[model samples]
Target: GESVGLHLPTLSVQEGDNSIINCAYSNSASDYFIWYKQESGKGPQFIIDIRSNMDKRQGQRVTVLLNKTVKHLSLQIAATQPGDSAVYFCAERPGNMLTFGGGTRLMVKP
Candidate 1:
């Protein structure tokens, strides 16, 4: 049978270091991808995004890379900090709805 979904449930990093979180999306037709960060009790907040047409996108201290060939996406954070510790998720927009991955917990050690 063909695979339908993908997820990564955890990640860890040390303060002042770099962190890379990855996700594999199942939809080949997805045109939009977003990376979100959710603190302990807060709603998911937009971190960065990349369109299907683009391979990579960058924001302040953050970068998102999309590899359509492998149906994979990754988020890279520079200078990981304590406050940067959170649960991060990748969402894919296949059409009108967004499918979210299982989320990776970013642990920042001091």
Candidate 2:
């Protein structure tokens, strides 16, 4: 089974800091990986994505690094802000379906 789950659901960070969220995946063959940020009551929005062929990908203020050797993945947020506080989840396309990670909640402190 190819599933992604977070080690923690809630993370607290100062208004102007950096945050790192971790995720564990169950499949090494999953070719497509995506990081999504979900606010309070909305659907997950795409932040960044990486393919099996690559080990790293970056976006505006986000970076996704994948380690297929251990089937592990991580997301790093630079300059964490209040608006950057949200739930982050990872999804992988294993077969025809997308398996999503449990999700990590981030809290920004001022």
Winning candidate number (TM-score): 2
Could you give candidate 1's per-residue lDDT for residues 62-105 as a string of tens digits?
99999999899999999999999899988998779778877899
Runs of candidate 2 with Cα error greater than 4 angstroms are none
Which portions of model 1 show Cα errors greater than 4 Å? 1-7
lDDT of each: 0.87, 0.89
Clashing pairs in 1: none
lDDT of 1: 0.87
For model 2, which pairs clash? 9-105
- Candidate 2: 10-residue stretch with minimal lDDT: 1-10
Q: Per-residue lDDT of 43-77 in model 2, one digit per residue for the tens? A: 99989999999988888888899988888889999
